[model samples]
Target chain A: MELYIGGISQGKLTYVCNKKNISKDSDLICDGAGCTMEELLSKPFVNHFHLFIGRLLKEGGAIVTDGAIAPDGPKTDSDRHFLLKPGHAPDPEKIANVLAKDLIAENPSVVIICNEVGCGIVPVDRTDRLYRETVGRCLCRLAEYSQVVERIVCGLGMRLK
Target chain B: MIILITGGSGSGKSEYAENLAVKLGKRDLLYIATMIPRDGESMQRVARHQKRRKSEGFHTLECHTDLKRLPVHGFPTVLLECMSNLLANEMFSEEGIIKTRGNIPVVEEILEGIAYLDRLCEHVIIVSNEVFSDNGSPYAETAGYIKLLGEINCRIAGLASCVYEVVCGIPVCQKGSGIL
Candidate 1:
């Protein structure tokens, strides 16, 4: 089954990925990075995973990881892991299609990291509002593809298995 | 009251804001001008704005990048003319240059300062140019700055009770009714 992890805290994901034996693979296709969607899709890979931290992940065909922001506290763990992502919108689907093709072709268990972009007040600017909507749609698409979904609040993880 | 007026270059936002301040009969209007006297044309623009405000007898506060240090004497209206320029000044400032990429602490500090000013003022009007309008792809740094500026502008606009989008010298208020 595909596993997705996301949250606003980078440290948490790094820790989890390390524990789960997921590190930067030369074969990994990372469309969520600043690279163009075309570049990510074109890259050859067996299993594709997208990692999103403080930002939104809009690319398709992968399980989504939830990386919501942490609430007020020291670096210590708490129950706020289910915090939502920050930001307004998602990247275009055309870009996401590139990444989706790679993940589906390989049929490997793909994990995605995405920020919950809708946890804040709605923005007044059109572009800002559009961003939030885009991110939300991206997450929805990712959830549709995933066999399981999970949310992290504070430091606790609840699996939608 | 505190208002921030921001817009892209040549959007005529500053001119509209000047007119609005006058219509409000705020003789002691605190115009927090951000543009510096860089070149002759820029100098002239600053002078013209100063002259127009002076002719109408409006008080002005000229600040470079240090909004935190500006004296806040409880002005009824404070107009933060343009945030992009302020951000540019702060980002390229001697100390600002030392901060590395993705190090958003400085920008956060500035946002916090703006939020503080907004809370302290009675009635604030903010003006900002829409930098995302029809411009082709910009350099990476420029694009990053614009995105960051847009984020800050949206946050501030969210707090504003009134928001206006000035198009072709016309003010379209997106929120709140009544003219300034």
Candidate 2:
């Protein structure tokens, strides 16, 4: 696996296309913004991988913090009761690890392009904090599994690993 | 020598900076902390940093604002923990924003403070945040803070003999040498 990361609009996708000798609209590419998990696993290149995590979090996949399921909306008695269940709440870090494993297992040779989001000011919203934290952890795992990791700046790739 | 170290939150910039300081300095090492613990979260952060600095042979000094007025002086090597919180404290006064006082601007005041430390210390290792890369906030105050921090980082980098942007516990030298 290979990973390419940078800030928004730093031409990360363009750099990847040039490096891979492929076009932007090539069928080998998949956008995590709207692509399904199957498409992401099948494609050779995945862009906006952080957004996929964001979407999943919004869909109530893994927004857990402190071993408690953070409510995305109004909580009822059943929600409270569910919170009482032992060993049922999912951890964001564990979720990231599972996602990373899935990505590496299903698409071993995939190249990922994700935005650097954990650098900015701490978000006031709990979900935003969880999303960025989860994305950072996921990227860490992917980078560890990746053979080559580069940080993109102004259309230039700086090899980090 | 003025060294500016920058990286994102939880990117291990602090550990990198501390190690660099230990490598560069001879004996007297000063850690100037700028964050003011106003709540539990920030207090936890402060404690985490303190734990990391234990046995690192650093004499810490908490200077939340008015860095120019710091009394202690003459250290062989001085490490300022961060520039973002200091900049925010300077920029955002209780009355919204303080762009200028009399003639000196906020940036200049802060820079002057840095220059004071530079003049006094042999090696000044300044730690700053890489907060400019993310999707920016919609608030005007946030935009203003970002712009100011960008200016400060650029200025410091220009003066710095070494500038490092750390990522994933790895220090990537942006300018100068000796940090490899």
Candidate 3:
């Protein structure tokens, strides 16, 4: 896994495109927010890795299986996974662990674009704090599992690992 | 030359900035603290920082809100403690004073203040918290603060001779390779 991280609109996508010479038309590009692990794997390429955390939080802190797909949402798996934006989960750690394993099983490499979010002050709201920590922990897991990690600032890429 | 140092809370950016200030000084260095320790927690934070810098020979200047009219002294090296607090101070004034103004004027004031600081100090080492990266939605006003902080960070990165992101007690130079 190759992880590209930076703030929103900090040019992580542009940097990835230029570096890998990826053509958007040919490559399967999709926003990972509220997307499933299967949906993510279905696509060869992906960005907004931080949104995966959001999706996980939405899924009651777990990545629902193909059979256990969300009911209120579509079961076609066309592009649907979770519901909540940021909610208190049953067990976030278990969710993180399960998805982490699935992500490591991919045959080809995948580029995960994460938004950095742990540098600011702790939010007063409990839900906000949980979301921040969830994203932060997810990024740390991805970073450890990733072969290459880059932090982009102002459209420039810095190799972190 | 300008050096922009950033890090998360408890990431040791202050220590790194202080060391950089000491090394880059051509005259007595100025420590422009932007934080206003109104509450007890903040007051303790300030006291800890002061104790750390006590033997460093810095002439501290507590300029919380207004950086434009900073007493003009040709200090070769000056470290602005942080931009986040400074921005909050300028954005939301003291309680019961006046209605909190819009972000446009606050951003303008901050930009003007920074330019003035740039002119007064030869080597400006700016310290700022990384605010915009959080994943959750902030309050409407807080969201505005995040936007402005990002703009200022981008602008300053262009002007800075060096930029460092300190993480886990290490300084990672993001821009301007030399003179870290």
What would the per-residue lDDT of candidate 1 be over residues A61-80, giving only the tens digit for each residue? 22232322222221332222
Go through the candidates in order and give each one's C-alpha lDDT.
Answer: 0.52, 0.79, 0.69
Q: What fraction of the reference structure's interface contacts does model 1 contain?
A: 0.00
> Sort by lDDT, best first: what order?
2, 3, 1
Question: Whose lDDT is higher: candidate 1's or candidate 3's?
Answer: 3
Query: Pick by TM-score: which candidate is best?
Result: 2
What C-alpha RMSD separates each model from the true structure? 18.7, 5.6, 10.1
Model 1 chain B lDDT-worst window of ten: B2-11
User: By the TM-score metric, which is better: model 1 or model 3?
Assistant: 3
lDDT of 3 by residue, B1-180 (tens): 678898765445788899889888845988999888865446656876798777788888888776887885868789999988887777776721124444346666777887887887788899987765556355787777788778888888888889998643357888988593
* Decoy 1 TM-score against native: 0.48
Per-prediction backbone clash count: 40, 0, 2
lDDT of 2 by residue, B1-180 (tens): 899999876566787899888888847789999887875546656776787777788889988778878865767898998999888877765421264454457788788988998888889999998887667789998988888898999999999999998775567888997653
TM-score of 2: 0.72
Q: Which residues of candidate 1, in runs, are more than 4 Å off?
A: A1-161, B1-8, B95-106, B135-138
| Candidate 3 Cα misplacement greater than 4 A, ranges | A1-117, A125-161, B95-104
> Which one is best on lDDT?
2
Candidate fnat values, all: 0.00, 0.35, 0.24
For A67-106, candidate 3 gives per-residue lDDT tens digits of: 2333244543332334233332233334444555566675
